[model samples]
Target chain A: MSETNPPIKIELVSDPMYLCGARELVSCIAHRIGFDDMECSKIALAVDEAMCNVIRHGYERATDKPIWVTITPLSESDESFGGIEIVIEDEAKQIEPTAIKGRELEDIRPGGLGVHIIREVMDSVVFEKRETVGMRLTMQKRADRPEEAPRISSRSSCPIPAERRVS
Target chain B: MRERPIAARAGGFPLSNDNFIDIEHPESGVCVVIPRHDVDMSRSPILRSAIKDEMGSGLSKMIVDLGDVQYMDSSGLATLVEAMRGAKNANVSLYLASMNAKVRAIFEIAKLDAFFSIVDSRDEALSA
Candidate 1:
């Protein structure tokens, strides 16, 4: 009965603080869509980095300009791969997808690390410079155990292993 | 104009070292000195105190020098955002000075370029 449902989408305005807000937003939305805790953290980190890049380089030092982030979660039937998908769009500046290179944290240079972090955390990261407007960033995450639907946090209430029976 | 060195406490780090954070309020109200590298979650606590201490002294205008910062993560950006908010609440105006393209990039990504005043040099911030 649930196989024909569409994706869930969310939109938010971009701000300097949005970097942090993006992380929180992804964590909540991903959990609501059934992603585990670790998966949610990874998505949040990726979104944070990508939005940071849009806020920085693409916008050309302008913040008043509008930057939009849209998130859509792909349902299980369509994504047998067992994960979630999110898309972020900004009408600020444009980024050259070809020019983006992920940086090694060990290398630690300044200019270009955000894109690298985004790629590192997300299963699939796609960047497209819209014809004349801004840019679109797409990210996907795959769940290892969709059935279990692992709890986001693992701190169980009762500190009882199977061996410690009530009897 | 006397220059005083203030180590970044809780609200500062990565952008300025504990030993290198400096404040120069010659004609300008306040100036913040930043270091070259290694700013992340662990060092943010230091920044808070540095800014708070400066503001406590009644300095209204500020310049944050970031000539040396090579890398800054979300934690680093958070510290700055908090400081910006703190400064505003205290009626103090803050400006970022001498940001490297990399560090400056974080500001742009965070959309902070719209909220704070930034300049090419400390002198620029001081004069403004």
Candidate 2:
């Protein structure tokens, strides 16, 4: 099996306005890939949250910092079983990867839901530290296809488990 | 005659002069904050500051009109959560109104629909 689809790459300043552009791009790409309106929005939202985290936490809101994003379609031969892979990189302070979890939902406050939102929308989320500096966050979401219906998880149908639901 | 400053500032994050947000005083002790753009990480700070300022000014009632917000991310959601917390601490009541389908879906996914007081219209929010 061979993977050959060229990934779409976008580089922008660590500004919120640019995140809107990125969201629009991701929504269009997801729609082009046959995702429904709701699904496309979810994917775009996940990407938006990830980029926001990089800017606010990773880059500490340094508008001059550069944020790089890559969107690649996972090949059918891969384990993702046909999905999209989004990689976001930033040159900001690196923190413990385990600290990325969203706050307990039961607490009902704000300021920490970004990480949780990413986890809820994407199938897999991974955070890695770069060799010298910076950090990389990778997220993947499998498409919903008729043939692979069972494999697709709907947030509405498969609610976040009681144990995993953060306060 | 002197003109009154319409928006308050929170810490270093001032209410941007840009068209991204609009703050309105619909009634006494009630402020309505509207985001004319997508609520994402980039724009959340502005919204947060605006809400904080409103809370600080002793506005015990708030209604966030999402009528113009077509899209929102977790960053945006977090701002709302923070505002809600601030409102509680100050003994204020925060209400959200006119959320579009997409924005509403994000809240549903996060299971925050149960946590926040969301109404269908600005009128309902005001009355609530």
| Interface Cα RMSD, each model | 9.6, 1.4
Q: Taking the candidates in order, what DockQ does each have? A: 0.04, 0.58
The digit string of per-residue lDDT tens for model 1 on B1-128 reads 66554553343234424465555556655656454343443344455556667776567787667776544566576677777887778888788878766566556544456767888998887777
Clashing pairs in model 2, backbone N/Cα/C closer than 3 A:
A16-B42, A104-A166, A104-A167, A105-A166, A105-A167, A106-A167, A107-A167
lDDT of candidate 2 over B1-128, digit per residue (tens): 11123333333433453556677887788888888767776567778777776686657788899998888887788888888778888988999999988899989888899878999999999898
Q: How do the residues A1-167 of candidate 2 rate in per-residue lDDT, one tens digit apiece?
A: 22346788988899776787888787766655446667778888888888888887787778889888898766555444476788898888988787778888777766677788888898889998877788889988876664442233223232332322599
Q: Chain B, model 2, TM-score against the native?
A: 0.85
* True C-alpha contacts between chains kept, each model in order: 0.00, 0.81
Per-residue lDDT for A88-160 in model 1, tens only?
Answer: 7878666577877765544422345567657766778888888788888878776666573323333433222
Per-structure clash totals for the candidates: 23, 7
Calculate model 2's interface RMSD in Å.
1.4
Instruction: Tell me the deviation in Å of residue A121 in model 2.
Output: 0.4
